[model samples]
Target: MSAFSDSEIAGLKVARQSPLIILQPEFVVRAFTLNERLLVCNPNGRLDAEGALQHAYFSDFTDV
Candidate 1:
């Protein structure tokens, strides 16, 4: 959740992981209470989804 900005999120990947393959942060996969069964994505103003689309990784399919 630290890197909440969707535009910046595309570049903010995890530096380390077990397998060490391109690991991105799971801002959307957050801890939820047992009562919460459905997954809801409600980014009020923190996430800039439009700008994220222009990111190099996502904009260019070959880059990934």
Candidate 2:
């Protein structure tokens, strides 16, 4: 699992999915595991608005 930000917010698999970009650089890898988001690092993490729009995955099955 690749993540834009390696912060605790997006450190684990869960965070990478909906990766929360506490910083700015982590707004690309991915997000959206429990919640809906978009990015590259979908380690079930939060995501940045700009990056979230990159992946845009709705669910576990509906990965966009």
Best by lDDT: 2
User: Any runs in candidate 2 off by more than 4 Å, and if so which?
Assistant: 1-45, 56-64
Best by TM-score: 1
11-60: candidate 1 lDDT, tens digit per residue? 77786544323243332222122113223355453335454444343533
Backbone clashes under 3 angstroms, per model: 0, 27
Per-candidate Cα RMSD to the true structure, in Å, reads 19.1, 17.0
lDDT of each: 0.40, 0.45
Q: After superposition, how far is residue 15 of candidate 2 from its true place, in Å?
A: 38
**On residues 1-64, what C-alpha lDDT tens digit does candidate 2 reach at each position?**
3355556556556444533555633333333242444333765565666554454342333444
Give the per-residue Cα lDDT of candidate 2 at 24.
35
| Cα-lDDT of candidate 1 | 0.40
Residue 14 error, candidate 2, Å:
38
